[model samples]
Target: MSDALDQLKRHLAPIIRLQQIDGLLSWDQQTMMPPKATTARAEQMAALESLVHELFTSEKTAVLLAKCESALADAAPDSDEVRLVRVTRRDYDKETKIPATLVEELARHQALSHEVWVRARRENNFSLFAPALEKMFALTRQKAEYLGYRHHPYDALIDLYEPGMTYADVVALFDSLKPALIALVKNISEAERQFDDSCLQGDFPVEKQHAFTQEIVQALGYDLTRGRQDPAPHPFCSGFSRDDVRITTRFDPHLLVKALFASLHEAGHAMYDQGTPEAYEATPLAGGTSLGVHESQSRFWENMVGRSYAFCKWILPHLQKVFPDPFAHLNALELYQAINRVQPSFIRVEADEVTYNLHILLRFELETQLLEGTLSVMDLPDAWNAKMQEYLGITPPNDTLGCLQDIHWAGGLIGYFPTYTIGNLLSAQLREAMLHDIPNLETLIEQGEFSSILQWLRQHIHVYGRKFLPQELVILATGKPLSADPYLTYLQTKFKELYAL
Candidate 1:
């Protein structure tokens, strides 16, 4: 039995490494690859990804998977051997459904589509990217069809990123959040006092911002030896393995909060990767359980801690030292208020906690509509503006700020938007649980101590990886099923006090 399990692990290790190599290529395409190399990179990505899928879905993999499953049939359900087989089986079944040719096509298009998005966004012309996007969606729809689903085709797509999550689940979650969110937005708008965020906006050098952000992420427990940070159009974290995680942040030369918070956000992800046990490397359990759980860590660090008053106090001195002209004389409460000010924003990444989920809600609806063919790609810009007006009460003046803002669709991430909201909800739930276990969590933040918090995440969330489903991991970490109550309460309490509503 042990030998069968060992063979399964050994067989899967090279496949995992190949997948990581594919990921590394993706990271390079986004960060370091030259614009002119798009064609070559696309071919490279297609070949590598097609090979990975073929290897993963091979007859040998199937035989090993079956052998391991049979051998571990009577093992404890939670044992690593059993969980590894379970996760591998789930992945194997999904991968084997689609043809290698389809995999190659999707990979090639994703790479080409990303370059189109970059150029289109820079030129503020959605038309330049529209055809590629349409094709990507077409391929994605074909993918969902191949994967099969009981209800909505979107369910099959969403499950790839968030296991067991359905379109109905997202709809119900957002439906429950709408009334509360609307009330909060309304109350904040009509409040007697409004926060002044001018302190965060001013002349700040990019070099200084880079240096300061590095310090902040490192202080947040991201191991610099094992990880590094870079700049990207869209900030993201990529982990090839636990020891070689990397993060990227977008910088705004005039705004201090952009890079600072983005770094903390990506670092939260990097720390999670680094915290996973060394034994899980090159296995299905190496990274996050789901994109939603992964987002929880990033949002938790970026908002709950980095935007908290205590964090303001701890980071202010560092801020002043790095860029004194703006932060030199600012008080902790003032810094906190500036960073946490509630308002509708054009960019989702720069949005405050109070208005962040609204952005996700808009994307969720648009993506689902596009997937269902109810919405045409050409009319997507107008549809996006309508949703923005309806949800956030603001309209982006250009495609760059509107439909072209996110790179998800270009990368064929049709059902990925809802996970951001899921992350927000789980972050608050985790915070609530963390406070119960570590009463002085805020105090620790004020003193620049994040060991306990990271340790808590490591034990309860990071270690399990894909061994558990997202819902199960949430319940295990927070002692509750996934819920919107904590997130709504967190936003309501924080913003009401901030605005004195």
Candidate 2:
């Protein structure tokens, strides 16, 4: 059994490296790839995907997995070997169900779709992206059907990013959060907007934005030797290993907060990647457990740390050095309050913490309708606008600010929006737990130290890798199961103080 399991490991190892290679190429595509290389990049990805999918789901793997099961029977269930075998087997079972051709097609189309999304978002023309979105959605639905779900097609997609998650589960969770969120938002609407964040609007240059962001991320414990920061059309964080994390952000010369906060957000993701166990490198267990769990780390560091009063205090001196014209007069409390101010917005990435969940809720509802055929794709703009007005009390001026803003729908990432909320909820709860365990967390942050919080996450959450599901991690980190109470309370407390509500 030992020898057989070793053989199984041997078979799986190179495929993992293939996945990393693919990830690196994708990082390049988003960060440094030139326009002319788009088509070739798509072909390369499709070929790699086809090979990896076929190799991973081969008939020989089924035979080896039997021995793996026997070997893992006596091993601790939480062991990395057990986790790798179990998760790989599950993936293999699902993959072998779909035709390799279908898998290849999805990969090819996903590559093509990213380019389309970039063009559509730039051109501000949804029609340029409509056909691709239609094709991608059709493929996603078919993939869901192939994977076979008990309730909704979107559940299959959700399960890919978050193990053991279902559409019904998210729907029930969101149903509970909606009323509280709506009420809190209503309360904010009545509060006076006393703070004018016009200080963030000045003669800020992109070069300064980049340099300042790099400095802030470095101070926040994002290792520059292993990771990199680059500018992209849309901001994102991607990683192949702790040593190779990459984050991207877009800069606007006129608006200062966009690039600064985006860097902090992506830096949160980088920090998580850097925190993973070094032994797990080049294996399935090396990286984030799932996207939702990953988002929690990013949002936790980005909002809870970067926007916290302590963080503002620590960074204010350096900000005065980098962009003295804008931040010289702004005090730590002022920057903290300005960045934390509650406001409604169309873009999810740019939305403040208080209303970011609302944006996700809207997408979650809209996507559910789209999947059920209750809403037509052609009418998505109107539906999106109606929801925008209904939720934020303002309608988008165009598809660019509305339907075309997010690349998720265009890339066929249905059922992903809700993860943003889940991440936030978990972040708030986890942060609370950390504070309980280490009372001087704020003092540490103020002193430019993250040892306590980072150590807490590493021990409680990051070290586990993919050994357990998000549900399991939540319970381990927070004493109770997942709830919105911590998140809602956090938001109310922070924003009430900031906005003087």
Candidate 3:
């Protein structure tokens, strides 16, 4: 490497460490810090982010990048340094266009609003969180304007999580899936096979919930050596590095399926992180390529594997062991049907498969309107309730189950919701592709073996990391750019079996 390249590393190393410090602080804020620490934490994050920006955009750094880019282009594509330079260059170019004020405001709101959102969600009061959300929307509009766009403002936003993904594409995907999902829901709506989900309701106790879910996550092959699972109000996965992956979930005493499904889902994400290219650790290419790809992994495990009969058959005995009173008479078929039950629900996190994307679609629509200046923050609760009624056919009695329910906008993730469905779509596509390699996926899952899926993910997607755009990874893995066919097919097949249509 050239002297310039060495100097760049010397300057950038401290920035990378600062980023890690911010990450750890953010994780601790969510998992352990007191509520009073919100403002302090936000200031800390803003300061570190400012430092990163200054270092990244410095005159000397640009000189180093100019030098390194030339050398990196000539190096083997498989080399770690080449990939890091390429990935870092892309981030540098993109982030440099964004003003520091905008970035800091995003950080600041994410911290304070998160605390407000928690209380508002708990109290079912959208008004309490409305002002902060208003500030967030104003900042985000400035963001989309700064980012600029050719066809749609939302397209610029979409590029954040799923590069090359257009707002138009998601609309088309959601439009096509709507009829199929509606039909599936209608079919099951008339079915006589009603599951007594009441057994899953009532005071079951959180201690047992954690213990049972812990076993399920372990069986899913989460590496305790490289990762950990914790409890958070809204479950998520994050890390300082690939080897330090963390997953979080919340427990509800009255709900048996909530914590278990959450752990498996988050474990899927943890597996993806833990499986990321080891050579890329401490560099930019070390995690899933995008939120969409990350979501795909989680959805794959939660739906394709966790909700499948094969997995249920394997875990039914153990689930029964946890709460014998509620589960003793229940068989795998019953459990599978219950977990995958088609229901119109208020909360996105708790929504079943048939109606889940509708929840995301609702967010996409509302956020689109909000960003375009057509919807006001104060009016959001009404708009949210109306959409819930329109989409899911049930209105949340309060904001806690409606506008204030999700942690996304409160965390300044304005353009992130669509990826949840993108992940759902990509996960199904990846599952279809995997069946070609492991035809007996059901048998493998029944044996409590998940390495087959993880191995395929590492080979096809994880190893490349951010070296590939999200869409490029989709093409490499599924032989297509992006579509809703696989997701629709899976839902139709599984629900058709369950409802016997």
- Which candidate leads in lDDT? 1
Candidate 3 per-residue lDDT over residues 267-349, each given as its tens digit: 88888888777666666677778999999989988988988999989988887777887789887877877787787888788
> Between 1 and 2, whose lDDT is larger?
1
Candidate 2 RMSD to the real structure: 1.5
Q: In terms of lDDT, which candidate is stronger, 2 or 3? A: 2
- Tell me the deviation in Å of residue 103 in model 1: 0.4
Query: How far out, in Å, is residue 141 in model 2?
Result: 0.4
- Candidate 2 runs further than 4 Å off: none
lDDT of each: 0.92, 0.84, 0.82
| Number of residue pairs clashing in candidate 2, backbone atoms closer than 3 angstroms, sequence gap of 3 or more or interchain | 0
Error of 2 at 337 (Å): 1.8
Model 1 residue 133 lDDT score: 93
Record all residue pairs in model 2 with backbone atoms less than 3 Å apart, i.e. clashing.
Answer: none
